[model samples]
Target: MKRICILLILLFIAFNNSFGQQVLKKGFLVACGDDKLFIIDPNKSNNNHTEIIWKWVVSEAKSLPAEYIPLLKSLDECKPVMGNKKILVNSSSGATILVDIASKDVEFYAKTPMSHSVDLLPKNRIVVANSTHPKGNSIELYDLNKNEKVLFTDSLYSGHGVVWNPKDNLLYVLGYQLLKTYSLINWDTENPSLKLESSWRISDKSGHDLFRIDADNFLISTHNSVFLFNTSIKSFTDFTLLKGKKDVKSVNYYPKNNSLIYTIAEESWWTENIYMVNPNKTIKLPNLKLYKVRKAI
Candidate 1:
């Protein structure tokens, strides 16, 4: 009994320490730019460019699978996510890898076939939006519970977004072309049916990402703007974001801190910087050269 108690205490301490290493507190902002990914703590009082905590160079310049080259070059399409003291990065390599922020190490990596998009699901499951030549587009669920995973859905449009609705335990999938729903656990689609609702158009053509905000609204971005959508009304109120830009790649609204981070463009593909907006709805962050990390989380 005494030995068991001692072991339990040690385990608790280790877990706590691991978590402490990840919390950003007040000093840092995680930033990933072209080729390089790092964490910057901007408030040093003495210096404006605070110390870089971690950095990794991600590029197709290195020897990468031919399949992934398309995904990497198409930088605007990659999306990233934070999970388990690590970040999950997925791109054309059709590969998903977990990076340990503390050690700057890749925890584990597995290859899938060109993941079009991935949704972070409960219990570390990655709900992937994918399509094979003949299968077409569908929702594929990767159970992190197991190492290499299996397909959750067999049919879906090739260009759609898979989203998890938290209010109720249901999966909300909106394709660039269609919309559907299923149970997050298993590929249970009884509520929505087999075929996605072709009733609504998710995007015009050059599709963008959808910000899963409050239960009532979802913030979506096209090439040049961000808009808030009220599902009940099936209408959207456009947020006057950085205008007169050639393109707007992606946008994320951080409501907990009352800020929104958006990427703008001077050209068709490259970026200017990430802008933070406030009450007057003005862009705040100092202008800097930043680019998308290129790997979708």
Candidate 2:
């Protein structure tokens, strides 16, 4: 009886240790302009020095039409959704697509000009950030069940990022020198719209990225610097680590340890490496025009 009790205790400890490690492991999804999305495990090393456990090329999406392939070039945003089972990807070239991770299936897609970022909303809806272009410079909403159809539109100059805040039930958009929030109007119906709730002018022009840091805070990056925004008080403070960092394309923060993984546009609007702090490592990938990196939730 004594030996059996000791064995059970040891097994319990081992299980807990393994679970803790899994919870702390950092994995990310990378969007490459060369038309690929990669899921990387930073803790593991392969022949390329970084383990790419999963990857998706445009050609691998069998369900996508051949005519739409060109629109998906220059992949810019890749955000994991639905517990990382699906990824929402968009490109500067002009497309936003939702892909099933395991099946490599194109679930939903739409042509969004100069698409920079995308987010999934409640009630089977999604939003796209359309940057500067003729048909761009607007925040477009769509129904996931109906592909290639725009449900609603609102003008936003140089719109670059869209994030849905579940806590406040608001949609936050980042644009050129502007940050705005909208309350969903008639979201349950087919003819839904967005009613502007509030707006704030950023310290500088050309807002590039907006990502949620926590329930009450969001991380915003612009052409000049990065700021930590508090939703409760509607204030912005410089994120000291990348306080004055210019041309930051994407920034994702893990609040558990206050660690960050981000990318900066080194060659025009893309880079060949992803930067991380709080262990401080740069993972370089050759022959890829990497644009954005998001935590694989």
Q: Which candidate comes out best when scored by TM-score? A: 2
**Residue 119 CA error for candidate 1 (Å)?**
2.8
- Cα misplacement distance, residue 150 of candidate 2 (Å): 0.5
TM-score against native, each model:
0.65, 0.89
- How many backbone collisions does model 1 have? 10
Estimate the TM-score for candidate 1.
0.65
Model 2 residue runs over 4 Å out of place are 1-26, 45-48
**Candidate 1 per-residue lDDT over residues 263-283, each given as its tens digit:** 665544445454545422222
Per-residue lDDT of 1-297 in model 2, one digit per residue for the tens? 999999999999898655434432346555456799887787664334877767789998977888889998789999888766778999899999998776678999899999998999998799999999999999999998888999999999999999999899999999999999999999878899888999999998899999998789999999999999999999999998899999999999888987888999999988988888875788777789999988875
